[model samples]
Target: MQAAISFAISLVAMSFGIAKLPLGPWERGFLALGLIFVVTSSFTLAKCVRDRQEVTEVSSRVDKARLDKLLAEHDPFETKNL
Candidate 1:
């Protein structure tokens, strides 16, 4: 919800600022398109980074759990440490 509101406000501000610029229709359109591309790419990059980190964390957790399970099942007295 907060993000939605912030996005709305920023969009409105950008529109107003762009309207004030003394640019032709093509130029304005290009500017808007560039802004959209930048914003979307930024979001995509951030999400990709976050997803990678999450995958790494999940992988590490799975590995840790597996190791813990193996340790729990092993009998220290009768087992050869390998």
Candidate 2:
């Protein structure tokens, strides 16, 4: 969600900056906002990819038999005391 917002902000800012090139306001604010959004989205995407990779790596190392055994021990319908 944040990545999407950042991308949108970046696009808007970049557009503003481009539009201002002809009007002569320089659009410094929009340009800076665009840069910030791009950086933030890049970092967010990198972190998400890293997390997904870690999860995939861990899942690949799991022992199916042990997992089944653990699941078999649980009673899904039973209520437990906290």
Candidate 3:
């Protein structure tokens, strides 16, 4: 998809930029490490958000089903036996 393509392009561009930097190899290695950490953290955050949303949706569905079942069993005009 477009998002995948964009991500790839950006990663390549960043790598090239880092390679072209005048800094020492150690600095570049540090920057690459930071970039990797950021990317991994971003993925983790996105997965966590998705999982939470899915849980919320499932909880809502269960609540709605319970309400529907209660309503189905309810009878407004039924008189209770003494």
Best model per lDDT: 3
Candidate numbers sorted by TM-score from highest down: 3, 1, 2
Global lDDT of each model?
A: 0.89, 0.77, 0.93
Give model 1's TM-score versus the native structure.
0.76
Model 1 sits at a Cα RMSD from the real structure of 3.0
Residue-level lDDT tens digits of model 1 in 20-56: 8999989898889987897799789989999999999
Model 1 pairs whose backbones collide: none
Off by over 4 Å in 1: 1-3, 79-82
| Candidate 3, backbone clash total | 0
Candidate 3 residue-wise lDDT, 1-82, digit = tens: 9988998898889889988999999999998998888888988999999999999999999999999999999999999999
Candidates 1 and 2, the one with greater TM-score:
1
Candidate 3 global CA lDDT score: 0.93
My TM-score estimates for the predictions, one after another, are: 0.76, 0.47, 0.88
Worst 10 residues of 2 by lDDT: 22-31
